[model samples]
Target: MTASTSTVARTATPRGSILKQRVRWGLDHALPRTVMSYAARKGDLPGRLIVESGNVETADLVDLFDAARADGPLHRGRFSFTTASQVTVKEILTSPDFRTGIVRAGGPLAGLREWADIDILGPLSAPSLLVTEPPDHTRYRKLVTRVFTVRAVEQLRGRTEQIANDLLDKLDPSSPVDLVENYCARLPLTVITEILGVEASDQERVLTFGTAAAPSLDLGLSWHTFVGVEAALQDFDAWLTDHMDHLRAHPGDNLMSKLVAATEDGVGLNDAELKATAGLVLAAGFETTVNLLGNAIALFDKHPDQLARLRAEPGLWSNAVDEVLRIDPPVLLTGRMAVRDTTVAGMRVPEGAIVSTLLAGANRDPEVFTDPNAFDVARPNAAEHMSFSAGRHYCLGASLARMEGEVGLRVLYDRFPGLALQPGAERRPTRILRGYDKLPARLS
Candidate 1:
């Protein structure tokens, strides 16, 4: 049972595994889609947004948000209650009546949670900070919050600068290069691996695992895609077992090692807790930041005026990062399930009702951001966006990501002021997460 002995990369996934994934999709995704699509037909923004196929464009999103806004801040949908108002989003996210989780307890699809079980740890599952509440969430956050605090990120800034510099230094930017492969992905990859005590040799393996498994964040994935993701999760789960065992025996001065040894009130994280925490940290540590970097690069290429402003006042780099997150966030939306009957924004949200908040829509709420559709790096209140989610579940790596985004973008531009972006940038396929998968560019 201990895949603790297996290598990171295994042989081809068996044919039966595809069948297994198909069944998972049927229960986990298709079932949800049926509800969502039904809701979509009856005027549900969140439902339509997820099930609608084809290339997602900014224009299409604007229409959805406008419709949701017209329908008012809080309205009931078959899948969940949907909201487009920024204020409602803030309220729903910060409310005590709501709780952290994807599936609502005793809700129509609650059975799917039990059916969704897998051997590998998923970020959205239990024992992870993402899904647990209060005491457990508080305890888990306490253990790692110190390392990601603003002050802690400030301490890590020097090393981050060096990491960014080294990544860009190796870029042969002479001809066309995929910035994602060359620079954007590597900077965060190096920094996160160093924190986790993983060696250079294992970073790419980690990246592959994360890349393949990233779609696990989105629902309603095609059977084939879901199968591939499961394979990666299985491989990653096996690798983590071996790595945690290694770290325990030969502890290093890194988060994973510290996690292995540190105890909370005389009790340390159990194996499930340890793997879930470590794996979530490992994937999250790099994945979104990779999106942030790539998204920023593409945005800058499109808005040289913003770059000009940043160049004029390099001090604005930090706020500029916020601007990028606001306009083109790395994550699109998040849902919160109600634990008790509570009225939000004058609407009665009963127990077990799921509140779907369109974070990207909230960011673009005209009432909150002036010229909401326009990309303005110096929009005085640019940092007000809820791209990081709000309250307890706010991204633990927010400070780290902000620092990385600022450092990565600033270093790349300063190093190559004449950087020219090539045509044909493509966004990632996952609906919940947003960012570029490939960005072709040239640095002169």
Candidate 2:
């Protein structure tokens, strides 16, 4: 067997390990929610936000965020601090004083990491780029970041446009359709899977796994959601193992194939590291873009004036994409740990404090944008939004997502200019990853 296969083989989940994973998930759900809920009872904003992150009425989040902003960006709670100020959010994200991946450096759950790692490949896990800090993250990123660069994503733009056109061709403008399923999901799925060298047949399985596992990024998951997500993640990990094996044997021109031979200096990523990197790239590449497309369509349907501006002058399409991201970002929030005691937004944060930065709230901060709550496609500073996040942990797929959003939305409206959003649009229940799961639209 090859080195890649051998490395992957050793990481397989033992049946005993699966049960341990279940216990970890349960502890994860129970402990935090218990603490957060107790704090919420005493009117702690940070705790309230955690407890209600998955609320269907997202306006509650908006209200809580507004309160946070009014509370001056950093609200110290029983366990953590919450911030909705753009300045503080940027400082926390950009500063080396903060880190991701740990539950808390010196908190109660720090030991859980070494105890319960049991072969689960979560985005928040050590090997994945979302949580890993420098040196390691820098290494993984240096090798994998090339394919998603602006130039590289620009290379894919024409192909994405063609894909958009092809997807549009299948839609009939005379009747109602669910754009989320028919267009929003398929466009990115096709593009990213092809980029990763995944066959067309496995795209749906990728989608199923992505849908089931998207919640892995959210905090305080219930037992049912946690188990289901972990199970789906396992299946995805298995598929990735076989896919990596195939790529090693018959390397193609795609990114996955490049990663198969990827190295820095003389050392290459091991199988577990490779699998973690590829898995995140594949899942995150399409999942968030699906949300971006759906969010843009829903936003455009709600604001015809902005959509009309794009219709009259197509130059605004690129900015329009950023505008959509600004107003209704696909991701709602992210958290960071203070590596050492630090001051943020004129407030004190002790070491190990979990700082919850509300990206949606920061995007709408009045201190940053005039009439921040309004949706304006031509807003000059729309590109400043933290929708792709900020600093070293900034989104890897931002360029691709932007390109896909512009091409996909423009292609749809260009194909059927009079498209109208129907009622009953449903938001995906996952908190961290926000977007519509179903958006019914009339093509005529």
Candidate 3:
């Protein structure tokens, strides 16, 4: 077998491992709702959350977040400290002392490195912009920013619209379809691949690997998932290493080629750093956009009147995109560690304390957003949501993701004026990423 095929073959998850994941998924649902409800009202939330681990639905999560926010901007708990207030989350995210890496020296989760066996994962464990401190993050991000400049992303608009229209054309309007698979999943996967210069045939494998690797970002991962995630990362690193070499010899007008040539302060990234950076962009860009598109469609289905408003005013697509992002952020929560002792929103956070920023909760802060739970497409200032996060780590793909979402939603509704959700829409069984696994829809 060829090298790429061998990599794919070795990394495939076993049937038994898949079965284990399914059983664990069932247990997540079987956990009592009353326990979580009662805890939100009367008990120790963070302590109880050590068990639930933010596994509850989005609506249910708001209640817990509200309760947490009521206490203070920063609440120290048994399992983790959390910042539910927008002001506090922004402060922590922007603080020069805090870093994203879990294994940082003297950080709260530093010990987890050995326990999690992160070292064995090779490039998977390499610190990319997502999980590195300044100097390194600043340097790496500067190179990436040059490639994703505003003009560059804007140039992608015509092609993105074309891709959206072409995907829509493939759908049979008269029949029901799983919008997640047939529409939402395809768009970002194709877009990121085309941007990364992956061959058409290899794009499918990239997508498959990305699906497994995405979960590596989760706070809690099962052993089965761990094996699958590491294997996928290994495969991706091998492919990326080869691709970087090829890009060096024969430059193409693509992001990878630009990255290959990018230099800063008379320095450029080596092969390992290149793979990690590319992997970070691909994995983060793919699933987050997938969820973002899925959330917009699913929310529109539930709020028909708002959908009608959007249909009447296609210009409000940007507002609709922001509203959906506020209501159902693809990335639910992120964590940061103090480089030293710090104060957040008047709360004392000592050195090594890990502060979990509840992004979705911050988006729904009543102080910031009036009627925070309601989905109003026409709501003014919807762009104020903290879903894309803030400070230096703000999503690099935020603009690209937004454009794709706007175009994807607009094209779908324009094609099927009466698009409506079928009865059996299913949310993915993930706590960190909130999105539908299968949004059955009728496009009549």
Best by lDDT: 2
Model 3, range 357-389, lDDT digits (tens) per residue? 889889999989999999998889899988888
**Rank by lDDT (best first):** 2, 1, 3
Q: Lowest lDDT 10-mer window, candidate 3?
A: 1-10
Residues 1-444, model 1: lDDT tens digits:
210000011112232444555655686667777888787788676788776622475435878877878878886776578787999999998888987654323544444433443222234222477766787788888776744568856777899889888887777868888898878889998888887888889998999998998877777667787678768877887787788788888998776777777776887777767777777788777788998998889888889999999999999999999999998888877888887899988888988777778888899999999999998888899999989999888888888899889888888899999998889888788777778788988898
lDDT of 3 at 429: 64
lDDT of 1: 0.77
* TM-score per candidate, chains pooled: 0.90, 0.91, 0.86
Better of 1 and 2 by lDDT: 2
How big is the positional error of residue 86 in model 3, measured in Å on the Cα after superposition? Answer: 0.5
lDDT of 2 by residue, 28-145 (tens): 5667778888998998988888677774544447788888888567877778888888988999999998986543333454455436643332342225777667877888788777
> Lowest-lDDT window of 10 residues in candidate 1?
2-11
Q: What is residue 322's positional error in candidate 2, in angstroms?
A: 0.6
Comparison by TM-score, 1 against 2, better one: 2
Candidate 3 global lDDT: 0.74
